[model samples]
Target: MTAKPPISALTDHLGYWLRLVSNHVSASFARRLEAEGVAVAEWVVLRVLYDVDALAPSKLAARMGMTRGAISKLADKLVAKGLVDRADDLEDGRAHTLELTKAGRALVPRLAKLADANDRAFFAGLTAKEREGLKRLMERTAAQLGLDDIPVS
Candidate 1:
């Protein structure tokens, strides 16, 4: 049999750490969102629509890293729930724009609070400096990945 490659450093590799942290973060957020009667993807769509007055479907799809078809399904669900509305774009008859309805706008702040609470619950033991370090490191990595232009607001 051929000699097997040795495991150099599986325990503390950067990718391993990233995946572990990300998985925990995502799973925690998913649980938090479930309690609020929303799925993670739905929250992502609502959160993105929270800040803007409205955006074209194409723009929303691009920003959310989802296909237009997927965005449409999400939008449809939101629309059914009376949290969002879609209307034809004034400038482009064939295209549509989406906006959070009054109820949706109202729901966003509560969801934001849920998000904050989830973060606090997950990182309460960490010192402020550690949190800041993580934020800075994440920001630097995002910048390095040329993802700084995506507005989180």
Candidate 2:
């Protein structure tokens, strides 16, 4: 019988390296968000809602590449926290539009600052050029993969 080839080490794959970095970055950001009394998913939703007057739940779900049910759940949490408001769509009574409350609007910038700080904290080892190159490479990879989803988790 022929002997099987040995399995590769965990670090042998590019995905493994990427995941290691991603896990650390995401966990750090999650902690930062928690300190602000928000979840990563909630932050994604709020960031999207920050610039808009109001947007339909269905549209938001599509834009975020999430299911309507998932969007609804997130929205429910935000609404409960008094950070978002849900009102009946003017043109479609059956549908609802979501908008940030005044408090939510106020919190978005602060959260954005935290996001910036978290990124700097993790990536500060890289030079500015290296950081830009890494970001460009990641964006190119995502575009190549046709990945448009707003990563919530």
Candidate 3:
């Protein structure tokens, strides 16, 4: 087997570059969401529910690549904030599903716009074609890495 590179050698590692860029992007977005009284994960949950009327907590957990317990906890917080409702499934009262509240629904568009502006601010120098190409390549890489099933939200 080949020897692993030293930590100092990470400057030339693609993974290092990916992680650095990811950290900066996530941190910047998190800061922007803070002013709106939301956390990054919370915003992700809200955005997911914004497009769908109702979805099982398990489904959400799978889509978010999180645990059921985590989804339950977040759901509780969202319920407490009046941002989401958790109710027994009509077809199967034993099961539960989540739905966004009116306030949550209203915030979806605003949050989306915030995300768009953030992207523009970060990549303003890149042309639209460049942005599209980046997205296409990223998607292709993700698929090749067996991540095509992952939810965008």
Candidate 4:
């Protein structure tokens, strides 16, 4: 009988290591956001709206690399939370635009600080240069892989 080739170990793949780190990082951030009464997905929406005065849901969806339906659902939740306002577009009565409310705008900076803290806690061992290099490498890898999906979770 012919001997079978040995199977590769789970840790042999680069993806395994990446996923291990990603899961931890994402879970940590999610918990922080939850404490602030926002989901990771909601934070993504609010972060995108931070600099913009208003935008169509279609445009926002495009920017977020998410489906319009998903954006609409998220918008509904934000609206109910008093974090976003949905209004008719003056240029196109049939269309609508979304803008962050005063409360939403106020919360963004605080959330941003939380994000910063989370990153710092997770990457405290890395020097500034090391952090930048790691970020650049990840960006290059994502670009090479055509990873356009915005990380909502």
TM-scores, each model vs. reference? 0.89, 0.94, 0.88, 0.92
Question: In candidate 1, how many Å is residue 77 off?
Answer: 1.1
lDDT per residue (tens digit) for residues 11-111 in model 3: 78888987897777778888888888887788888988888888899998898888889889989988998999998988986789999999989987898
lDDT for residue 51 in candidate 4, whole number 0-100: 85
Clashes of each: 0, 0, 0, 0
Model 2 weakest lDDT span, ten residues long = 88-97
Best candidate per TM-score, number? 2
- Tens digits of per-residue lDDT for model 4 on 1-153? 999999999999999998998899899999999998999989988988888888899998887788999999999999999999999999888899999999999999999999999999989999999999999999999999999877876
Select the stronger candidate by TM-score from 3 and 4: 4
Tell me the tens digit of each residue's lDDT in model 2 across 31-121.
Answer: 9999989999899889989988799999899988889999999999999999999999888779999999999999999999999999999
Every candidate's lDDT: 0.83, 0.93, 0.84, 0.92
TM-score, model 1 to reference: 0.89
Q: How many backbone clashes does candidate 1 have?
A: 0
Candidate 3: RMSD to truth: 3.8
Off by over 4 Å in 4: 1-4
lDDT of 2: 0.93
